[model samples]
Target: MDSNWGSSSNLDSEWEEHRRQMMEEDEEDDARMRTNTQLTATAATLWTQEQIQQEGPWGGSVVGRSNKRRGRALGHQKLMMDYFVPNPIYTLENFRRRYRMRRHVFLHLVNDIPNVNPYFRQTTDATGNLGFSPHQKLTSALRMLAYASLADQINESMRMSESTSIENLGEFVVQLFTRTRMSTFDNQHMRT
Candidate 1:
């Protein structure tokens, strides 16, 4: 009877360890699901797959036709000149003429697609009008958000350490834009 009691107690201990491991795995899965759900909800709010693909360098895992040349670094003087030029209308018009695309299309791409300025939300009031400068602000915000998202996904899927995953994520973001022939032009920073 004493031996039987000891064997039963050992079995109980083994079952407890198994139960604990299963619980831990289940908790981790739930946490991951919650994170994924939050990201999905955020993505649904702002961008569609088509917009993400066409708007910037990260083109939703597909390649598009674009020139494959390294861009020249713009000097501070050049950036200042471009910003302080005081001819938003003229500059936009000149750009449209050069591209031979409709001005409205350019406006849409800049304002809606990139929507770089963190302050500016989608405005229903402005119809066919461009209203922002220093386009880099908006593009930077978009890029950072994308990089973070991709990094998180990599960490989760690959089971990499956090720091390593983040470093890899940065490289991945750079490559995402660079792999495309149009990467130089699509990335606002790369545009000379």
Candidate 2:
């Protein structure tokens, strides 16, 4: 009886000790988490302060600081001379081969797309800098589609950013599909 009691008491003490160690470990983990959270908050505060300092009250200068205008007008001129002009540098066969479509069809799309979606329309910025023309946006989108090329591949030739190229592609696809669907519906209704 005495031996059994001694063993039970020993077991209880061992269990208590184990529980105490586990609680201590949990407390240490909680402390670490709290410290990490505080550090993250401090870092975020510092970043906010830096940004506030850099960007003045008006904020135009800092906002425009990173925007690099990539001479889109020159790119548009080069594109026109290369393909869209009456006596273009590239022949009809070259245009067809590169664009995977007839020149007329490409031009028709360029002409019609701006009517369907205003995003294709060229506009001037607040600083009176001309934005990318419809021709440039469509050409970039078509090149990406025809070549299965990455958006960045069009950057140098098209004078647009990778993100802009991707955006143009997405918008082009959506607008084209919309136009096609509406035309198809009209045709079906007319036949009916």
Worst lDDT run of 10 residues, candidate 2, spans: 55-64
Determine which window of 10 residues in candidate 1 has minimal summed lDDT: 68-77
| Candidate 2 residue-wise lDDT at 181 | 56
Please give, for residues 22-129, the per-residue lDDT of candidate 2 as tens digits: 999998997797566556445434543454455434324454458776899999999999999999999999999999999999999889888878999999978998
Q: Judge candidate 2 at residue 19 and give its lDDT.
A: 100
The lDDT for every candidate, in the order shown, is 0.42, 0.80
| TM-scores of the models, in the order given | 0.26, 0.62
| Per-residue lDDT of 30 in model 2 | 78
Stretches of model 1 off by over 4 angstroms after superposition: 48-192
In candidate 2, which residue pairs clash?
Answer: none
Q: Please, what are the lDDT tens digits per residue for candidate 1 over residues 115-180? A: 433333423223443322323222233333544444234333333223333333233233333343
lDDT of 1: 0.42
